[model samples]
Target: MAPRQKTAGLLDAVGPAFSRLRRSVLLDVENPVPAKDLTRTLVLNIVEDGADGEVTVGVVAERLAVDPSVASRMVTDCIGAGYLVRAASQRDGRRTVLRLSPEGAATLERFRQHQRVAFEYITRDWPEQERLEFARLLLKYVDAIDALRAPA
Candidate 1:
């Protein structure tokens, strides 16, 4: 086979493998806290990143590429699960902010630790140079994709 064909085959094999790997790493049910609801968990995580210790449902919906109502439902589910809190903004009564509670923060931290351990295990044998190169390549691809998706 030509070198081009070999590279194409390798890329083809990588696509499904990456999908399965991503799903296993991100949506594993055997996790200590488990992923009972991925959409809710993801929204809660976004809230955790806010400087105000919370994020608005509208912003989350924009980030998630979903409707405001869908994001509100996810927030409601997270609230019911005790993973998040919904509060009216002190400065803007009309807007609602979602926050991760103490319990929620702890759970999120544990999940991060699990993910770190998983990545560490997976890359344990990887050479430093190779890993650095992989990171650069991945970032390049990500940037290219983002550029394409940017509004004209």
Candidate 2:
């Protein structure tokens, strides 16, 4: 195959592979979290990235490329599920800060553990060089996609 054809084929294969992997990792287990819950949790994680404490819902929404109302609703659902807490911001009384509850933290950790295990299993037979190369290429792909979505 020509280089462009090979690249297109890889992209096509990768997209479906990701969907399959996502479903297998997140939906195969008993009492699996629904897609919405998983998405909300991921948003929370993005908000908490490298942060010591409370983050505003707006920040989370921006990171997730979603509207604030959507973020607020997700936060409310998380709070109702005992996965998040919302409190009046000290710096801005008009705003609310969202933080993960203890249960939320534990649940997120469990999800990460499962994801790591799944990844390890998937790559168990791969050669070390191939694994490293895959990682580099995946990161490059992610960076390129993210850059394309960057605001003008």
Residue 38, candidate 1: Cα error in Å is 4.3
Q: Candidates' lDDT values, in order?
A: 0.75, 0.74
Give the lowest summed-lDDT range of ten residues in model 2.
45-54
Whole-model lDDT for model 2 versus the true structure? 0.74
* Candidate 1 wrongly placed segments (more than 4 Å): 1-18, 26-33, 51-54, 132-152
Clashing residue pairs in candidate 2 are none
Residue 78 displacement (Å), model 2: 0.7
lDDT of 1 by residue, 52-145 (tens): 6448888788878999999888878888889888788877888777778887887677777776666666666999888778778977997897
**What does the lDDT read for residue 138 in candidate 2?**
81
Error of 2 at 139 (Å): 5.0
Best by TM-score: 2
TM-score against truth, every candidate: 0.67, 0.69
Q: Which residue pairs show collisions in model 1?
A: none
After aligning candidate 1 to the native by TM-score, how far in Å is the CA of 14 from where it should be? Answer: 7.2
lDDT per residue for candidate 2 within 1-152, as digits (tens), equals 99999999997897799888766765655456667767767865865562335587777777777899997787778788888887777777887777778988887887777665665666779998997798789889988986896668
lDDT, residue 97, model 2: 78
